[model samples]
Target chain A: MLQTEQEFIRILRSRLEGTLPEEELNDIVSDYAEHFRIGKADGRSEEELFCSLGSPDDVAREIRATHLVKKAEDVKSCKNIFHAMLATLGLGLFNLVFVLIPFILLVVLLLVVFLFGIVFAIAGPAAFIYSVLQILGIPAFAIWQSPVAGVFFSIGITTFGLLLVIGDYYLARFFYRIGIRYLKWNISVITGTEDEA
Target chain B: MNIQFKKGVLEICVLSVLARKDCYGYELVGEISKRIDISEGTIYPLLHRLKDVGYVTTYLQESAGGPSRKYYRLTEAGRKEEHEQKEEWMRFAASVNALLEGKNDAAD
Candidate 1:
């Protein structure tokens, strides 16, 4: 035989996946085994059998020429994926920060506006109702003042809060969708040229 | 019909025969020689290819008169490939046949 089990195994491990046809490897092993057995009919040594079979490397070159392709594609794809991931990460973070900065600023501004609405609902309205009661000679209702205006003010504040909540929810969802698409596009880009992907 | 063109397909034929049952390298060479004229050396490369592709495996059994003989058996994969190769050749030959038969009626 031109090869031992270990030598043959080395050649097998070296094969690039999807390059060699599966049927060819089977014959190589059987032929060498037969050759080794038949050559031994005359009481030849194992070493002598190996010598006549020629170098494993010589046989390998012919097989590899048909079965092996260049490594350049894998190397190039790996590099492209790495750079794409880094670029996507950077851009995602930038977009996230961009969304967050304005959101935070809007929240702060809304908070300030709500504090004033609360003051009007509690102190400002209370004083206004009291002064109006004094001018009308007697207190109008059993409750002493109408809370109608404050009721309207609270509804406006709640609606404004709801719009902000909804806008934030949709904005976050949009960013998540974009990130998913970015990941998918990059994955396809990396795997697009592969035979077995 | 070109030797170079037949090279790849010849190995397919050799393996297809062996896949049906165990065969010796010399026996395989003889069988191929009957189908097409080729040197003994050419058969080795084909056997090497079949083993490399995992379509066959070997065992050593001693005969009564001489040394141990290496017997080659077709693995399941080899049998399957033989069937597939047969189908492929059938399709190829049939297509060519249809085309040639359409344009001429040599039998008539």
Candidate 2:
């Protein structure tokens, strides 16, 4: 294959066409076109310029990862964030430990907290109902030494559960925001290479 | 001299250079690669990312005997980012250097 200006731009365009928006595609293409044009004018050969530019495919991967990560940040959806993580994972195998492990752990942590919150919230209400029934002489199951104490305890439990749920939500949001920033930093720092990992 | 190490600093280098003066795409890449050996193609994507975040903006300017060239100028935010990243990097490097030169340093 000939290492020429046109060839470099072609590879870049072909790799990025479907992923990047049309306007973005044109802007990126033009940057490299200008590079080749100016380099040639400066008396550099096509091969020399191409060599210095490294692999267009690698460049496209970085661009795609950057774009997806930005999209995920803007939209704030599961699908978007998942796509962004997948794209970043392509940058290198090291991210399997760095990005993927932490992401999975966080997801699991949030889910367990949410489940516990819901269970406590529902159980608290049910316990309160039993206490009321017992007070009315309906022979309900006893969960506490006194029906009055049970009512108070159940109310406290319900409030605590609700707070846990709400706190978990805010925690998830905070982590999501920080996670997006970390992925952006990861792409910029760890993934500029000719060999795709 | 590792490639990953070079890639990490490229963003700050580009922003620091632009904070001084506007540069065309080729000119900016040339300025950076002159000092740090890196794949020049990656700079364009980095520039686009900076632009997307409103840290930088671009314009076209006519050159002698050539088509108008696209020039990148740093925004006020870009300057702030450059200053912050430069300071953070300097502090990080200093700490790492201090650790490396400590008495337990294994490699000479």
Candidate 3:
């Protein structure tokens, strides 16, 4: 394959066009353009410079990952962080084990907690209504041995469920912050090792 | 050198070099690649990340015979980071070296 400056820039631009803003994309492209320009002036062939620069696809991947991660940090959102995680995962197969597995586990864990909270919250209210009906002499809703105790228990359950939901929210947020830091560190430390190719 | 180890230290290397003096993108890549064996392309992304984190700033400076080049200089935060990372790396390296030497002596 031809390792020309044009080819390199094209690959980079294609990879990053939709992900990065135009001005920022242009800025990144210009950096490499300048590098190639300067290197050519130094009497190095385009091939040698391109080879030293390594693969353009790899470069673009790293840039994409970094930019997405930064964007995620700036705008805290599930979508942004998920995009960042996907980008980082593209860096290498190593991330499948290191990033993807943990990410899936965390998501599943959060989802389960959220679902449990929802179930308990909804069930608590329904049970409370049933207990009230039982107290009002509705035999059809007479599941409770003690109507008054059922009322208190249902209220307690509702409060506990609400607390669990709220706690889960904060837990998700805490994990989000920690996850961002870990992704940043992971990108810095784990990336670029594949450049040996 | 282990590639993973090299990748981990690349950020510190860039910071340490920029700490010495401002350098253009190509110049900075040259400075690091001159010693370390890694992709020169990765440095640009690292530089961008540093800039994003408020650790470095860039400016256009005219070169001798060509168009102006983008030069990167460490920000105040960058200098502090460089100092802290350098210290940490030194201590960590020293401990690792000591442990390796002790293990070698025991083996002998």
Candidate 4:
């Protein structure tokens, strides 16, 4: 209600997210027109309302914070898209290298050490318990019947699982790094940042 | 806010907000001011970007007491984007946390 209906529509379309329907824009325009009419003389321009209302960019920022994807979509195609994609992917990579990778490796190492340590330290006892359980006939599943086969299989499963997890974790990190680097390269290529070089 | 950082992340935040409800220009100013210390003028540019992408839909409504007001709402794509961005943020943040204190300090 700060300017004429037409002026309000233009401002809303330009100042707010542009995706609003035309009819809705008309309504906004009328509201502002009425508000401006009540506030001042007919000779005054809608710019006054714009100024008093505050920076349109500021409003966009607030709106964007809430509706980032919509706002991002309308941005000039070649201009911001690369950057936006770079943003998420870059940050994700940052997390992977500085945070995720080392942490995962550490966990893997600990797990391996713990599992092997148990084998060396308390494993004898654990194996004794396994045979005892078989004698007690806990279940077909529990009674491996073959001590060597069961022990080897248990070791194999634990080691294989640990290796597999560690391998997958490292692979992910490598792929993420490559992906982000590729994306950054694409952004630079499209934006012509190399010219600055 | 760092201009670079703000420019990158702010767009995501705005779209996410519109995904929830339709808001007017001034109402947006009031809401955003509550959280981050941003120049009120910057929001205008952000809105422009959203329009370009076609993620948000806007319409004007008549006010009983005042002039018509422009109200912004999210399109289908806009809603999906909000969820995606949020998911990414949470996962990224969690991954970051895992790196810091979650590391095996005892491994060495």
CAPRI tier for the interface of model 1: incorrect
lDDT of 3 by residue, A71-158 (tens): 9989999999999999999988899999999999999999888888888898898999999988888885677799999999899888
At residue A181, candidate 4 shows an lDDT of 48
Against the native complex, each candidate's DockQ, computed on alpha carbons, is: 0.06, 0.57, 0.68, 0.08
For each of the candidates, give the backbone clash count: 22, 0, 0, 59
Q: Pick the candidate with the highest TM-score.
A: 3
Residue A115 accuracy (lDDT) in model 1: 60
Per-residue CA lDDT of candidate 3, range B1-108, in tens?
766788889999999999999999999999999999898998899999999889999999888989999999999999999999999999989778878777555334
lDDT of 1 by residue, A1-197 (tens): 44453554455435422444456565455565555566566477766545444455434443443232122122334334333333333323342354345435654664565565455445545554554664566554434344455445445555555556555556544544453344433321221111210
> What lDDT score is found at residue A25 in candidate 2?
91
Q: Distance (Å) between predicted and true CA of A61, model 1?
A: 5.8
Reference-based lDDT, residue A77, model 2:
88
Candidate 1 per-residue lDDT, tens place, B1-108, comes to 443444546756776778666877756755776777443334565565467569888787777887666677888898889889889998888778978779555335
Per-residue lDDT over B80-100 for candidate 4, one digit per residue giving the tens place of the 0 to 100 score: 888898899878777777677
Note the Cα lDDT for every prediction shown: 0.52, 0.89, 0.91, 0.52
Top candidate by DockQ: 3
Best by the lDDT measure: 3
Q: Give the per-residue Cα lDDT of candidate 3 at A10.
A: 94
**Per-residue lDDT tens digits of candidate 2, residues A1-197?**
78899999899999888888999899999999999999999999999999999888788888999999999988998899888998888888788998999999999999999988998899899989999988888887767769998899889889888988999999999988999999998998877453531
TM-scores of all models?
A: 0.38, 0.86, 0.95, 0.38
The per-residue C-alpha lDDT of model 1 at residue A62 equals: 39
lDDT of 4 by residue, A6-93 (tens): 5444555585445445564454345444445543543545665455444433333233222333333455342343333433333232
